[model samples]
Target chain A: MPLSEFDIIARYFAQATPGRDDVVLGIGDDAAVIDPPAGQQLAVVIDTLVAGVHFPLETDPYDIGWKALAVNLSDLAAMGAEPAWLTLALTLEQSDEQWLAGFSRGLSELAGQYGLQLVGGDTTRGSLTVTVQVAGYLPPGQALTRQGAAPGEEIWVSGTLGDAALGLRLVQGGLEAGDSAAEQLCGRLNRPQPRLSLGIALRGMASSCIDISDGLLADLGHVCAAADCGAALQYADLPLSSAARDLIAADSGLGDLPLIGGDDYELCFTAPADRHTDIQVLAGQLDCPLTRIGRIEVEPGIRCLEQDGSPRSVTGQGYRHFNESS
Target chain B: MPLSEFDIIARYFAQATPGRDDVVLGIGDDAAVIDPPAGQQLAVVIDTLVAGVHFPLETDPYDIGWKALAVNLSDLAAMGAEPAWLTLALTLEQSDEQWLAGFSRGLSELAGQYGLQLVGGDTTRGSLTVTVQVAGYLPPGQALTRQGAAPGEEIWVSGTLGDAALGLRLVQGGLEAGDSAAEQLCGRLNRPQPRLSLGIALRGMASSCIDISDGLLADLGHVCAAADCGAALQYADLPLSSAARDLIAADSGLGDLPLIGGDDYELCFTAPADRHTDIQVLAGQLDCPLTRIGRIEVEPGIRCLEQDGSPRSVTGQGYRHFNESS
Candidate 1:
């Protein structure tokens, strides 16, 4: 027997509702109301994760909850928005108490960790899918976007990239690494840390910003295209986790995975040449390693440099969900 | 086969993009940023319509689109918020052009009618479900809620009650009615008119307001429970189409439908006893009917009465989608 909609909401989502002053109404009413600071604009992002397409059919519900909300928060982080409120629309294949409890516990814990509030949402019976809509706030004129880079600006990124994508391969049993590296990568894929506070701090300083979701190179292409510029990247300067590099070297088939695989969720940003030292100082306090790996140039094409100072193409097709189907 | 995320967005929802300054960033980016007026608070609402639950599998996609957005807008209306922006997350079974075109046409037409701008959303491959999140701005301290009604206030509603429920029965072949009422009721059920403008006009006037998504008696219970007051309703005073009354007299099953069915989307509110004349005047200008059906009472329980002064109770068991599956 299936659970009723009211029971599903009362048991799962309402149980996870965060205690917050801004949420005047939560869960039960026709809608939810949140009062943000008077001077701030609401930064909203929505994303959906489907069962077979977005994750393995057997992925744990707790991780799914974390990933769904974390990914949306990552988008807000790219915009330099402070986490605020969220609404979830869940379509479940079935109602299992254990699954609901685990998923909500994971989601509520993360929401409390990020200082975010779950305001309202809807639940329906269908194939398993989760859609989370998040609303954050940024003071007027402070959001970082993809259209502000200029010639002579330096491009930088925080943390290593592609660990999440590598983790997916390992989960599918298509690849293997040493126990420690494999566990670390799989954890990265399962639970991503969104850079909210770091984003707020980088608001006025970063010239341009984009989250490395689709892949580092493909995502940077978006920023460059929007800013009407080109870029030159140094392969030696790329931030690759020691574990990822070792795993890739262990299997030649994993070559270039760091450049083309998706789901890194790190902030890649550009800054004016003069502000590099200030950003470096700021990055130290952020606890995330910041690496200046590229430069925005006046030209209109991307060029990668090998360790030998020879030009190279940093292109391997990025992960495309549609391509697999079509 | 799977679809690319970008292709999915472009094919279904990209056309509704509002391309304006208020929308600092739109669909192509990770999140959307909307600039709200300085002194106003944002009122947000989200609702989902599943294929088998909310609508019949063979129901027209155009009406589905209209209802999904309309219901969200109706939530804003209940709070006396001015509809401004909307984000949609559509989980589709497949990309059907004819269905999409009709759905888009219906959605765009209704959006244009209300001057709403579509800002951002996500499209994914999954079971057919439509979720719309709508946001509006309310003047500081003026938004109406169900928690404001006081004892001795008069209860009022805009437009006829239970027409949508009647229409649903007729549509599903559960009940038959006169041709005019059948057409009107079915239209009401399919295309609910969100009283946004009227709701805005009532902001400071209506002590408590709720959109009649649930039936009159049960929705009124929300106001009663929230405001800590009881209500007395006069059933003979209910505003109903002559066709509906005729149908009720002809069919025994139609007797309980009005009190129990849902999806009316009309505005139910309470105001000072003296405001009935003013409400009627405003109704004239709005070209909608305002019916005085009940009064808030000092006691803390519900009571209903017939024209013959017989005591009655309202059994408002509104349609529950999740309950159907259970």
Candidate 2:
């Protein structure tokens, strides 16, 4: 017999994470009641992932669950918020017990790491889709936003760029797979980490911050647009993994991926030049790579310069779902 | 020349509701930040509506927007929470300007009534789907849950039952349409008013409550299961609109609808027998019809008795998304 909706929830989703004191009521209720701390404000974000749109349909369910939650956490992380509670609205084509089990495991493992409780959500039968909403806590008047960058501020990014986009190519058979580097890139595509710790550490140090879900140039374009500033990027300063460098070296056309590819899930932030030393020390303590990629400029457009200071024209404006060609 | 993702958000969704002081940041950011009051606990709920499954594919976009938010608010209402914030995840096959305009209007009008500010969400390209998550405030320790009903408590339901189910039939062409009664039923199906005021008023009085989304018998079954009790309903006492009554009189086979039909979005609750007079007064104040349909029992199952005291067997258990047949 096929599992009913209630059975699926009870067996796979009801106990996804341990109970938290702030969660007065968790799963198995019409709505979850939560007690937010008195002094802290809440940061809420929602994101949807559709099969064959956000990811390939053949992607593992485990990776789907992990990536779904990770993307929303990335948004909260950009705001320097502490992870709190989550609600999931899952629409599946059918109730496959194995798929549900894998997805549950992936979601619960990450949720347990952050002390996040799965509060309440709806599970329905439809085309495969996952929508996750996360609410986190932020100190009053201290939220990091995109509108705080200033001219001459140093732009910094954590982790390598373009790996996830490269990973997607490998997953889609556009690139040759089976190599160790290929596997690593594919892993990056499947499970991009949310930079929560770095976001929290840079609370007072960084002037503005955003997660690089829509490529370096495009997401930074958003920050620049919001701050009413521009940015100048040193091409050599952009961080790249050895695999990405190798691929780009083999075919220079692939060099644009580091600038135009989406789904990196790394932080792109700007801060005063004098804070550079402090950011380096913080990066060492956190054991996360931090690269100084560019600087905010008074001009009102993004520029990428070569080592000789010549400009390179970039064409793509990152990924948009409803563009004319798409 | 099609609208891009960002354009769609900025034009149709960014300013769907008036700005509120609690919303520190609204749209056009990585996430939204909100400030909750000191003395209140937050109640959170999420629901999803998929085209061709939850509603007909040709249904009006305005009703789709209204209902997506309404169902989630209904859950909060069931918990006696005051509506506060909402996040929507909309998945569309294409970006249609006319559809977007209608959806925004319907969403904004309802949100204005409740002072609900749209915080943040994602707009993605995929099959047509709408997922809404709502956060509301509840006085500390004052939320109504399904576990509070005791034996011998009277079960009462607000407004008419089975109207939305009949409305669905009319919309689906299962029943003849175009009459005033059919139009009224269709309207009931599309726009379910979440009983927020009534729910708030019942906070101190009702022992247990649930919104009737999945039929009267099935929802009462949930309350009974949670409270570890049973219910006995009087068949003659079930409230019905004139249209529904006339339809049932014409065909006895449709009699089970009021008992087992779903999507009523009305509150079914249990309270102490002593509070009957107070509840009647509340009904008069709210101008919403209230019906005393049943009583909680010491037994472990639900029963429906005719006026002469004969029991009627109920075989349906309301709607479940992933049942064997579904």
Candidate 3:
């Protein structure tokens, strides 16, 4: 009477994608068939999340499934593409009915919101691993790449940073939050919301963009290397949620926690000086906070400074798969 | 002085895929960009080949690379699609230089020949497993599905079946063959020749098709079940290579080896009975053999017969993943 693969797939993982007519074949075939809009390019990305690597071993399975697709969708979001179809390569450790049901349920909810279809892939037996290959469509010559930032452009980011990392520390018992706020931050760690709408809003306006996966600084370095520009960040301008600020203010040992501790999944994009007001308007319309925390410069290196004018050399603290053992 | 991820990727993988206008972006970026042809539906398929599970543990990695992509290509072929692009997820046990060189060389050769651009995928540390996802396109309303075969249709198989299985057994020391014949069969097992040309030829002519990954009997059974019809296969009509015949004739216990042994990658399709001659002629044009091996029936199951008038219910011996290690 426990959940079979069929039961798990049907009950919680069934069709929940949004409306679209371009799909010729959806979740049931060898692959999802889509009619790419004429003159548009298809952007594809694959991301794999392994147990004990991307997430904690004791984390919720639903969060694991949700985030696996969510991160790939985040990649599509970074490129200003409309996610269409996804293929999941899942290697399960054991077939647990309860785990699969919750996992599929979480995945179904997200796929429904984005109108993305589950395409064709394989289920294999192995140590737990989820690899998702997502395809999205970007209008001709319109994809947001990381190499287009100009020296004079303003640097911007969506939503608050460091909450997820703060959540992580809280979950690990290294940091403390009040009972009310602790639950919220821990949920942030388990379910990092991908800013899909923000990506779409910045398509043409932003000169360059990348999601904050490997910390704000490390990921910003990618934009710098690709764009051949330098950056000057105003630490005081970085918008921190009251929850993150309260947690960080309480813990003095976590240096540059917001700058280096990754898993924010927010958009860090750059745009021309004149487009700031337009971005502000878009932010207001979308109901997501847009923070202008830095500016592009011709000096050809990244610079972070406090309001007191002291240089803050932020090092990368993002999870490196092999170097650090959990 | 050894191969880093980027070096191995650049030397072996990058620029190895064929350059086509449809491929807007190849390797060396965050992801790949492609444009599926206008008015066509993209067909996608991903297949994984684990060392010691799919092939002999000591089988040349070069052929492993080739067969990995080839099997995925076969799935596209079954759908009457034109090969377009592929992504590879390579999970290596270690970064062995010699193994990577051979794998890249073989994979590059196959990718170039089939007009597929190596798109985007993942690389990770794990037990040796290679997953290749292939994308193909079929003109709207023209893709041959497994559900279209009629009861009165003629079942045809392109090229030969069971050569690879025979080749594998010979290499595994289970069966003996002459040195030259063994070499040939071994090559078949290693580098499967996907019937792409035959599949394209049957796009409009064939009603239903499936690539023979599982043995002909099992795969044809899949087609029959999907099409909601039965089939009566003529045992003597099976197109067996000289190598398969010699091996089977020599072996004493490997009962009806061709019927159950799989991984042929040959195209088994059904066409209207009246177009049999045209189908054969088309096969000749492509230099690929097309043999009529069976006829569809109104009943809902497969029946294989001997050269004598007696009906024979053969034991199902097609490959199953669990049968090997699980």
The true-versus-predicted C-alpha distance at residue A146 of model 3, in Å, is: 1.0
User: What is model 2's DockQ versus the real complex?
Assistant: 0.83
| Consecutive 10-residue window with the lowest summed lDDT within model 3 chain B | B317-326
Query: How does candidate 1 fare on TM-score?
Result: 0.91
Name the runs in model 2 displaced over 4 angstroms.
A324-326, B324-326
- Give lDDT tens digits, candidate 3, residues B109-208: 8888988888777666666778788888888777766778898899998887778888877778877788888888788788888878777778889988
Query: TM-scores of the models, in the given order?
Result: 0.91, 0.99, 0.92
RMSD of 1: 2.9
Q: Write the per-residue lDDT of candidate 3 for residues A119-217, one digit (tens) a residue.
A: 666666566677778888888778788789889889999988888888888877877778878888777677777787887778789988888876888
lDDT of 2 by residue, B35-142 (tens): 998889999999999999888899888998888889988899999999999999999999999999988888888888899999988999999999999999999999
Better of 1 and 3 by DockQ: 1
Better of 1 and 2 by TM-score: 2
Q: Against the true structure, whose DockQ is highest?
A: 2
Pairs with steric clashes in candidate 1: A325-B2
**Candidate 1: stretches off by over 4 Å:** A1-27, A297-305, A309-316, A320-323, B1-4, B7-21, B175-180, B298-304, B311-316, B324-326
Per-candidate Cα RMSD to the true structure, in Å, reads 2.9, 1.1, 2.9
